[model samples]
Target: MSTPTSPGEGAPTDALGRALRLVSFAMLGGVVAIAAVAVFTVGDEAGSGVDAFGAILVSVVFVAAALFVPRRLVRPWPATAAPNEVKAAGQLRSAAFLSLVFAELPTLIGLVNSFARGVWLPVAIGALFSVAGLLLTAPTADRLREWLARMESAGARTGL
Candidate 1:
């Protein structure tokens, strides 16, 4: 009888890609959950435009962070030797983790603003930004291949 292959028995890149996608989807779902919670609990305590200013500004900054921080995190891999799949996977995972965390920040901020000030606009704005960030940074198969190719090219360049 043939023994069944384990979940992680695939190539490192494949396994890592699957894990990243799962985490990304979970984070996106959390944004939806935040919206549901706010709808059910937050009251129509209409906030002044001035009161929403801070939440809007903070959410914008967090969304920008979600867009840029992950690229910086993965940019410093030591390509002095050769591109190692294991090391590349580690770096990708780190970048993806930060990407998801940063993306989720706006939703959390929105939830806080809703509970504290009862403004619903920030929740909607934040959820929109959060979803965009999550979708943009999601580790799909094409993205994974591109990243690996870039790492390989960098390694080749530095090896000379």
Candidate 2:
């Protein structure tokens, strides 16, 4: 298995890995910031039971998106480019960004619920899911390389 590499920590050939690491960390930071705000401001009591229900619904949707969107976004392109090609880098970056966004959605929704309904449960749930999902699905250098390898293999098998 390839060891995970941080931004600028790998050889020159690992530029894509470095870039992906930076992007992933930045996205994770944003999610964490939103969660922090929700967690810190948990005393508002303006939310109705209906708002709580809506929060539940949103949380479910966010979980579903987090589970499925990354796989879909990382699907191999039709091009026959090599795994190390520039096209692969673009695909990897796009996949990482989209995945991070999906992972962060629950936290964003939770923050909004906190502000709009002042409900604590929804905000708490959203914060939990956001932090957990972001940590669990964080993009690493190894993951980027693995994805590229899978894409390259798929393209070759399909004769793209």
Candidate 3:
């Protein structure tokens, strides 16, 4: 009875943007708090242990936050795509989707690098991996927006 929608953009920007921002700050605070706790609790005496703790703790929180918010926000977030936009689950004939996958590359690299050094030597590897995983999913919503905008413009020019 209703139209199909884009995944993350369903929430209108002007309205949902504030809520989204609020949620974002809250989530960020949560991760930072996790890091702060890890740092303060794990001082120089046991620097590696605490560093490991902070990293893993923050990493897990990031992953959990990413997964949880989308589901929670799904209801209230209306699809904000313009009519010509490429909705989620639509055909992926182009390379637009690659942006999302690669967007978190920087963060992932840092995490992985930390992990590589830590793996055999046993450092904050858990946290590094956790952060890397979190980074992996970071770009979806933005990538969707970018892809849709590209699609719309291209379609407009081609009269698609």
Clashes of each: 0, 0, 8
In angstroms, the error of model 2 at 62 is 2.2
Candidate lDDT values, in order = 0.71, 0.64, 0.37
User: By TM-score, how accurate is candidate 2?
Assistant: 0.70
State which candidate has the highest lDDT. 1
Among residues 3 or more apart in sequence or in different chains, the pairs in candidate 3 whose N, CA or C atoms overlap within 3 Å are: 9-80, 10-77, 10-78, 10-79, 11-77, 11-78, 55-127, 56-127
The order of the candidates by TM-score, greatest first, is 1, 2, 3
**Model 3 Cα lDDT, one tens digit per residue, 1-160:** 1222555545332232344335444443444444444434433333355445554555455455544444332221124543432333232222322322232232343244344444221123433443454444433445334433444443332111
lDDT of 2 by residue, 1-160 (tens): 1223465565332666666667767776776676666666766564677766776678677766765676676665555633354565566677777766777787777777787665566676766676666666667655666666566554442121
Q: Which residue runs does candidate 1 get wrong by more than 4 Å? A: 1-12, 76-83, 156-160
Greater-TM-score candidate between 1 and 3: 1
CA lDDT of 59 in candidate 2? 69
Best by TM-score: 1
For model 3, where is the 10-residue window of minimal lDDT?
91-100
